[model samples]
Target: MRKNKLQRQASTIDKKFLLLSLFLTVVGLVALADASAPLAQRNFGDKFFFLKQQIVWAGVGIVLLFIASKIHYRLWEKIATIIFFLSLFGMLMVFIPGIGTKLLGARRWLVLGPITIQPSEFLKLTLAIYLAKVSSKNKKLAAYFVPLILALSLIMLQPDLGTAIVVSTIGMAQLFVSGISLIYFASTLALGGVLGFILIITSEYRRDRLLTFFEQTRDPLDKSYHIRQILLALGSGGLFGVGLGQSRQKYLFLPETATDSIFAIIAEEIGFLGASILIIIIVIFVIRGFAIARASPDTFSRVLSCGIMSWIGAQTLLNIGSMVAIVPLTGIPLPFFSYGGSSLIALLIGCGILLNISKYGKE
Candidate 1:
């Protein structure tokens, strides 16, 4: 009877998490419909093309999440190391000339026959699983000093500095949950800050982005075009916005209107009020996620919850921050609001894992 009661309580808690995930999924599709309509209509002669694709991806993601939620979360522990190594290989494979396809200037995607996928997206999920599993055992190191440095090293190699930083933070959080010394944690933060500074200085493009952020008006037509446009969109959004699907910027006025800077586009069309509502929804989702994490029965699931929460929450912040020029352009999509099939699937799978964690949570 006690076991049954515990299981029922867990199921109830999990339902809340599921509803939150579903909320984000549905809202993302609706936003995508607005964000992708102009470009889809212009290119495909159909306004719903991208929206249809988003809906399909969302469906696939939900299914993937369901499967993940049903399975025992411990299975991830058994294969965590293997999964980490596989993702490492995938990250390395992105640099292999023909096998690795470089779009723009970054060689970040791999082509596997009909599928062209971003390994970093998968990296976010797998790294979380691996870190959670590994740290769940070694209480001292996991809670102490290893996670921030070790995990950050692997992520930085991808040259995905933003993700590397976020992943490092996630690992550190897991360590903290495991009971780390706060003084050492501060030192780790300082070290990461210095390393990030060094990486930014050594990388010319990143340096330019930092400079452009400060002097956007100085080079309005040059390196600062995207920054300037994103700023205009946000500024133009006013309080009530210009109205949905009526964004003047989407008429080729903003670059990556459907991808990286979609939030700015959303702000422009829907105004501050609409953006506030969206932010509230995301905040509620994050709170629910943390609730599930805290309510979890064991250490691994707690760490798992932390990892998953960090991945989605961090990515959302990076995407929106980059769009608004509060930070450098990370080129990351706005969660479900952006247009990437692989990204959507990976994210969904991660959420599913979280749902599973909630279902098996402790009393």
Candidate 2:
């Protein structure tokens, strides 16, 4: 009887959710192929260099997504603490002299021979799982706040303010869904806001980013150059766009064209209308994710699903919001659209787990 029940659940995974994830991933590859051509050619003498690597990562991500989907969602609950610590340890490994790779002044990647990964990316998912597990068991405030603060401190030490923000957001979202007291939630938010402000004012680059956000005309050729170019690309694509593969900005005009700023390239080539369609699809995907959370069979799965959706939604908002000048520039990549293997793989695995949880959700 139990075997039959398990088989039924496995056969009933959320198809809409799975299909949307795959669709966004495919669209991301198409956009990356166009956006990275010039940069790849100039840097590596091969126009397809970045695209080829991303395609390989995508293939791996898809396989993991399926494997994760097959695994029992409750498995994470049992090993949550172990994996969380392991991921936290991975973040620490990034600070080890020869093992850590420092790029653009940030020590955020672990380099083992030819393989490079940003451990902070995996930390986001692991932290979520751990928090959900503990919270579901009715743990105390110290249980949640300690791990949350420890993880955030390490990520900030890497000086990755963008990822720290995302991780903190994920932690807070899970805490909120787990039914923490309103007073504590409010206090946590206030504390986070105060700490964020202090961190920004104390850091030269962060202070400059904040200042440039408020005063776009301050340093057109220096601090604000990236945002200026982004705005130019956005304006160039009035309504229908200049058409795909024809973005002027992608031709060395935009910084981080294939990674953090890929969305701008998509907007430049596909226009406002096409960008709207992409945004709509993302919105639908997130909505379905929440629907799965709503139908989740238990508190752990429900909270975990919520955390995953919030992670995707918050990251997307930060990336696109920066592109449109709605918020200060955060060097976070768009989910599924970014060109990094670590991020893509981590996200797919999260989605896969979510799909597994959906199988046990109320029909």
Candidate 3:
């Protein structure tokens, strides 16, 4: 009877984590409605265009979250290798002539019938699963390192430096948690940094971004325009904010107002105080996620939980960091808040998996 009761207790889903996920999703929708209004009106003749699409995706994502929570967490471990390969294949699909959609000199999305998706976004989650599985079974760094390099190579081919960074961070985080040698981890970190610097210098546009970051005052109207606008919005929000739904930057003045730079809009509307509160909530969510990982009953669940939280934490930092000009703009969307179907759906599914693992955690 004691064993049975303990098992039952361990099987209960993490309600706090689930509610926090839903709250972020709902808050994202609210921010999107306010941030994308002008852009939607200008492009589609409907103010709620992006919000409507996001609402549908949010609904789909929430349903997946619950379904994923109910499924056994070990199921992913059984098929991690297969799904990781599928994710790689999906990345390759973006290079196909008829299916791939190229915009602004980057081939990052695929259009299938009426639906479009960014394979790299899903690649992040799949890679994390595969890494977790490999780490749990093998202690050797190369066991997971080879696949990490392969996935990073494929993503870099898409020329998405931002996502490549996030993916690499995810892999490295997993490697660390898997108890790899500190010397090997440090060596890899140094190598990655050197390679990243080389990549930046070799690409003209990327180099320009680096230079722009250093010389923000050089060209206010040209290369620095985007960052300038972002800073302006932040400045406008001063303390309390300009009031929600009244952001002037949303009127086509800020680039990626609803996507990569939505945080600025949020800061502009709610001010520093409101933005800080949101940040605090996100921090709490991450802390709770790690707590679940710490309590996991097996190595697989523990590593998997850590991977998911790392992905969220790394991406959130990148997005908000760039918005405030603390880091160079990387074109990565803020989780939940950014307006993209692939990102939102994949994230929610990952959260669901985390919730499932939480249920199996030791009391």
Q: How many residue pairs clash in each candidate?
A: 1, 0, 0
Please report, in order, the local distance difference test score of every candidate based on alpha carbons.
0.79, 0.93, 0.92
- How well does each candidate superpose onto the true structure, as a TM-score? 0.92, 0.98, 0.98
List, residue by residue over 1-363, the lDDT tens digit for candidate 1. Answer: 998886786564377778878887887787778877788888999988888887888888888988888777889989988887788788888888888887777767889896688887887787788778767787566343453455466556656777776777677677667556898777866876887799988998889888887788867887899988998998999999999777888777788877887898899988989998988888778888888789777888898888788777888888888876778787778887888888899888887887877776665
Query: Which 10 successive residues of model 3 have the least lDDT summed?
Result: 5-14
Error of 3 at 115 (Å): 0.4
Decoy 2 TM-score against native? 0.98
Stretches of candidate 2 off by over 4 Å are 1-7
Q: Give the Å shift of residue 167 in candidate 3.
A: 0.3
For model 2, how big is the CA root-mean-square deviation?
1.4
lDDT of 3 by residue, 1-363 (tens): 989977896679889899999999999999999999999999999999999999999999999999999889899999999999999999999999999999878989999999999999999999999999999998877788898989888888878989998998999888888888899999989999999999999999899888988888868998999999999999999999999888999999999998999999999999999999999999999999999999988888888898899999999999999988888989999999999999999999999999989887788
Cα shift from native, residue 155, model 3 (Å): 1.2
Clash pairs of candidate 3?
A: none
RMSD of 3: 1.0
lDDT at 61, model 3:
95
Give lDDT tens digits, candidate 2, residues 1-363: 978887787689899999999999999999999999999999999999999999999999999999999999899999999999999999999999999989998999999998899999899899989988988996689988899999999999998999988988898899898988899899999999999999999999899999999999887998999999999999999899999899999999899999989999999888999999999999999999999988998889988999999999999999999999999998999999989999999999999999999888776
